[model samples]
Every structure is written in structure tokens, then in C-alpha cells.
Target chain A: DQQVKQNSPSLSVQEGRISILNCDYTNSMFDYFLWYKKYPAEGPTFLISISSIKDKNEDGRFTVFLNKSAKHLSLHIVPSQPGDSAVYFCAARAGNNDMRFGAGTRLTVKP
Target chain B: DTAVSQTPKYLVTQMGNDKSIKCEQNLGHDTMYWYKQDSKKFLKIMFSYNNKELIINETVPNRFSPKSPDKAHLNLHINSLELGDSAVYFCASSQGFGEVNYGYTFGSGTRLTVV
Candidate 1:
């Protein structure tokens, strides 16, 4: 059983547009959510995160929104650049340190 | 300098062979974890250690053993490797045990192929 899931496998957006990626989770214990961006051969780097307490968190051009009631979350990147194209993963953390990661979504930003 | 480093970026070995992948973290963290990403790109946790003590051990096979010689190093040893063992393994570290406040930092990853 997958605790976290990314329904969309891929997404494409033009330059200077907004790129949105969605994720869902089945576990109610998850209180912390994080988004990580990964390049082809490199490890995943943290992008943004949101706690269950807040509905949204933004950093620079990246924003993460969480809907605890719906058990869903989304990541939005405004003015998407070519460098923003990569695999994005959504991870959820419960009380324990163990984190559950979604399958990942490949985002393509056209120049 | 890399905060988390895992040796043997790529390993290709025959079935039934024994292999080991070493991981080291210099982030002065108290917890370390090992995660495996299969062909489908599904990442799952295999094990987690805090202060050289085993904290979480997923339902991984007995052939896969994780050893933590110290708090900063966690190594994975696989015995009687099978063809299905081909995947990418990642090592990560965090500041504290069971703390969601501090996010994890992952290594580049070691790709293991069992032929």
C-alpha cells in the first residue's frame, strides 16, 4: 500500500508560466510535508516544506500548499525557468523520523 | 565538501556475490538512513540508525544487512545478491532522531546491478 502518491507522472509548462505539481497521502499521522527536486544523476535537493499547522509556505518562486483535511498538497513554481525542469518528489513525515516518498513527477519547463 | 557521501557510485556484480556500499555523513547529525529506489522510481526506506543504534528496520531481506560502525558512517552489505537487487541506493542524514523539523540530506546514490 502506498502511503503517499503523485497521481500525475509528468507535467510541462512554458517559460515564465506557473508549474503546479500535486500529491496525496493516505496516512493521517503525517504532519510534515516536503518537496524535493532532483536532477538526472544528482541526489534530491530540498525545495520547500509545509507543516500541518499552516496551509501554505512560500520561498522565492516556490510555494507549497497543504490541505490537511483533503490529505493533499501541491507545489507551485511561478515564472518557471529552464533550470526548474527536473523530477519532483513529495515526502511526508509522521511522528517518527521515517519519511514516505511519492513516486515523483517529471516536470519539463520549455525555454 | 559533500555533507553526505556514499562510495561505489556504480556496482555491477554477478548473482550470489557479496557486496558492500559505504556511506559517511559529515553534517554532525545524529541519525542516518538508507533508502532504495527501484526501476519504477519508487523510493522506500530500508533502515535507519540513530547514534549507532538501529531505530527502524523495514521488511527488507535478511541478505541485506546494514552496519553502523559509528554515528557518522552507515554501510550496507548484501549477501547472495540476486538479479532483483538491481537498484539505486541512497543514504541520508538528519540532525535528530524522529524529528520532522529537520529535513533529511541525501547522498548522490550508488547504483547496484546484479547480473
Candidate 2:
């Protein structure tokens, strides 16, 4: 069974707009969450992460919001650019480094 | 230079054949893992090794085996390959188990096709 889930398979937005990706988890044991960006035929690159202790974390134009009670998290990119188009994956880590990944969402930014 | 690398980017083999995918990391990470992405596009963890010791083994079949000669290397050997074995396998590494300060890094991936 998948502990982490990315319900939306794909999303599209115009450049200079906001792009938001949502993720949910069934397991409450997950304490660390991260987001990665992947290109075709390339490995997923680390984008940002948030610990369970915090509710929000921001880096540059990328921000991650976490809700422990809801078991949900979101990644937001402001003024999305065409170069930001890619497959974004949300991953979670449990106490022992047991990391689980979501199915991933394909984001397309139209310029 | 690549931090994590996997050999044989693509492989096509017949049924019942055996193949191996090799992975190496120059990042000096102590924990390494193997993840598979199937047709459903879900990234599933198969196995994890820390300091050459197997730490996690998921619901993967016995036909798939992971061998770690050293901390920097983790290899996957699949025997009696079936059509359902076709998927993209990724190798990843982190500093160590339970360390979340740095995100795990992954290799490009190896696409295995079974005929």
C-alpha cells in the first residue's frame, strides 16, 4: 500500500502565475517531508524540505506548508517559470530513515 | 563528476534471464537504497543497505537480490526475469540512516525491459 499519495497526476499553469502541488499521507509516523524536481531521463533533484516540528518553510520562490493534523503538505512556487516544468515528487521519512515517495505530479508551465 | 552513478542505462532481456545493475556513489554516504518505478509511476523501495548491511527489505520477490561490496557500491541482481519485472530502477544514497539534514541523492536510473 502507498503511504504517501499525490492525487493529482498532472497540472498546468501559465508562466508568471502560481503553481501549487499537493500531497497527502496515511501514516502519521512520517516526520520529515521533502520535495524533488525531476527532468526527463534525469534523477530527482532535492528542492525543499520541512520537518514535522514546523508548519511552514520557505526558500527563494519555493515554499512548503505542512499540516500534521491533516496529514497533508503542499509545495508552492510563485511566478512559475517555464523552466520549472517537470515531474515533482513528494517524499516522507519515518523515524528510521524509512522514506516513502508519492506517485509524483507532472507540472507544465506554459510560457 | 556525478555524485551517484548507475551502469547500463537500458537493458532488454528475455524471460528467465539474469541481469545485474551496478551502482556507485562518490558522496561518501553510508546508506544506500534501491527504488523501482513501475508502469503506475510509483516509486517503490526494494531494499536498503547501510555500511554493507541490509537494513530494509520490502515486499520484493526473492528473485531480486541486492549486494553491497562496500559502502560506496550497491548492486542489484535479478534472476528469472519476468515481463512484470520491467521498470526503471534507481539507486540513491544519503549520509546515514536517520539523518535528514541532507536529502538523499539518486542516480539517473536504469530501465530494465523483459521480453
Candidate 3:
């Protein structure tokens, strides 16, 4: 069964606008959440990660928010650029166990 | 030089054939991983090795096996390839094993097609 889920398959936004990608998980044991970005024909790369202990983590223009009570997490990119367009995957892990990834959401930042 | 690299960017083989995908990392990381992205586009971990030692093995068929000849190389071998096995396989490495890993550096995936 899939523990991590990304309900939206795609998202589109204009340049300099905010892009929000959401994800949810069913397993409450997951203590670490991460976001990954992928270009076509390339493997996914680590973007940002947030520990369950903290509700939010920010790195530059990318920010990840976690809501433990609702078992939800979201990635927000401020002033989205066309170069930021790519597939984003949400992943969660419970301690040393295997990390589980969502179905991924393709983000399109139009110029 | 590439930090992590996988061979055979694309492979098309007939069903029931055997194949292997080789991976190497020069980042001096101790842990290597094999992840498969299926038709549904979900990245699932198949195996993880730390310093050539098996650390995690998920629920996978016996036909699929991972071999680590050294700290920087992890190879995946499959027997009797099936149509269901067609997917993109990625090789990744991290600094830590088990729970201490910070993030992962992935290689360009190998897209396999079983006819």
C-alpha cells in the first residue's frame, strides 16, 4: 500500500507567482518528510526536507510545511520560475526504514 | 565527472531474458540504493547497501538481486525478465545508512523495456 500520496497529478503557475504542491500520508510513524524534483529522463533530486519535530523548513525560495495533526505536507515556491518546472515527489520515512514516495506532481511554470 | 552513474540509459529486451544494470558512485559515500519507478510513477526502494553490506531488502522477487562488489559500486541483476518489470531503475547514494542519511544523489535512470 502507498503510505505517501500526492493527490494532484499536475500544477501550473505563471512566472513570479507562488506554486504550492501538496502531499499527504497515512502512516503516522513517519518522522521525516522530503521533496524531490525530477526532469524528464533524469532521476529525482533532493529538494527540501522537514523533520516532523518542526512544522516548517525553508531553504532559499523553497519552503516545506508539515502538519502532523492532519498528516499533510506542502511545498511552496515563491516567485516560481520557468526553470523550476519539473516533477515533484513527496517522500516520508519512519526512522531507519525504507522511504516511501508519492505518485509525483508535475509542476509547470509558464513564462 | 558524474557523482553517481548508471549504465545503459535504455535497454529493450525480450521477456524471459536476463539482464543486469550497473551503478557506480565516486562521491565516497558508503551507502548505495536501488530505486524503481513503475508505471504508476512511484519511486520504491528495492535494495540498500552500506559498505558492500546488505542493510535493507524490501519485498521483492528472488529474481531481482543486488550485488555490491565494493563500497562505490552496486549492480542489479534480474533473471527471467517479465513485461511487468519494464520501468525506470535509478541508482542513488547517501552519506549515512539506516536513519542518519541526510539526502540522496541519484544517477540518471536506466529505462528498461521488456517485450
Candidate 4:
């Protein structure tokens, strides 16, 4: 069973527009959620994170929103640039040191 | 300098051969992990070591063994390689075990192909 899921396999947006990526989880024990951006052939880099206690967390052009009641979360990027195009993975932390990752959503930002 | 480094970026080996992947972390973290990314692009944890001791071992085959000679180094050795073993293996490290507050730093990855 997949504890975390990204329903959308891909997303596309125009330059300077807002891009939203959504994720859902089935495990209620997950208190911490993180977003990682990965380039081709490179390891994932941490983007932003949100704790279950907070509904939203923002950093620069990236913002992460969590809806604990809905068991869902979303990552928002404003004024999306071409450099923002990459695979976005949503991870949830629960039982142990390991974090469960979603299948990943490929985002494409057009010029 | 790279925080986490895994040698042999790409390996192509024949079936039934034994191979080992070496991983080292210079982040001064006490916890290290081995994660495998399957064909479906799902990253799953295979094993974890803390302070040179085994902590988490996922439901993997016995042929796959992890050895931690020290807190900074964790190596994975596989015996009798199979076609299903072809995947990208990643080495990661963190300050503490089961602590999400400190995110993990992952190596580039070692791609293994079993022919």
C-alpha cells in the first residue's frame, strides 16, 4: 500500500505564473511533510516543509500548505521560472528515521 | 567537498556475481541509510545504521547485507546478483535517527545493472 501519493504525474505552467502541486497521504501518524526538488541524475534537494501544527509555511517563492483534516498538502510556486522545472517529490515522516516518498510530479515551466 | 559520496556511479555486472557499493559521509552525522529506487521511481529504505549499529532493516533478501565499519561509513554488499536487483541505490545521512527535524543528505547514487 502506498502511504503517500501524488495524483498528478505532471504539471505545466507559463513563466511568471503560479504552479501548484498536490499530494495526499493515508497515514495519520505522519506529522511532518517535506518537498524535495530533483534534477536529472542528481539527488533530491530539500525545498520546503510544514509541520502538522501549522497550515502553511512559506520561503521565498516557494510555499507549502497542509490540510491535516483532508490528509492533503500542496506546494505553490509563484512567478515560476524555467529553472523551477524538475521532479517534485512529497515525503511524509511517521514511524522511524526513514521518510516515505511519493511517485513524484514532473513540473515544466515554459518561457 | 561532497557531504555524502558513493563510489562506482555506474556498475554493470553479470548475474550470480557478488558486488559491493561503498558509501561515506563527511557530515559528522551518526545515522546513515541505504535507499533503493526501483523502476517505478519509488525510493524505499532498505537499511539504516546508527553509531555503527544496525537499527532498521527492511524486508529485503538475505543476499543483501549492509556493513557499517564506523559511524561515517556504511557499505552494502550483494551476493548472487539477479535481474531484479537492477536499480539505483542511494546513501544518505542525518544527525539523528527517526528525527524528521533534520532532513537527510543523499549521495548522487550508484546505478547497478544486472545482466
**Segments in model 1 whose C-alpha atoms lie over 4 Å from true places:** none
Q: What share of the true interface contacts does each candidate keep?
A: 0.62, 0.68, 0.68, 0.47
Q: After superposition, how far is residue A5 of candidate 3 from its true place, in Å?
A: 0.2
- Given the true complex, what DockQ would model 2 score? 0.77
Against the true structure, whose DockQ is highest? Answer: 2
iRMSD of prediction 1? 1.5
Model 3 Cα lDDT, one tens digit per residue, A11-106 = 999999999999999999987899999999888889999888899999999999999999999999998999999999999986664688999999
> Where does candidate 3 clash, by residue pair?
none
- In model 3, chain B matches the true chain B with a TM-score of 0.95
What global local distance difference test value does model 2 have? 0.94
- Cα error, residue A102 of model 4, in Å, equals 0.6
List pairs with backbone clashes in candidate 1: none
Model 2 CA deviation exceeding 4 Å by range:
none
- 1 against 4, candidate with superior DockQ: 1
lDDT of 1 at B99: 59
Question: Can you list the residue pairs that collide in candidate 2?
Answer: none
Which predicted model would earn the best lDDT? Answer: 2
Second chain TM-score, each model: 0.97, 0.98, 0.95, 0.97
Over the stretch A44-63, how does candidate 1's per-residue lDDT look in tens digits? 88888888899999999999
Each model's DockQ? 0.70, 0.77, 0.67, 0.63
lDDT of 2 by residue, B38-112 (tens): 999998889999999999999999999999999999999999999999999999999986677468899999999
Model 4 over residues A1-111: C-alpha lDDT tens digits? 889999999999999999999999999999899998989887778788888889999999999999999999999999899999999999998756768899899999999
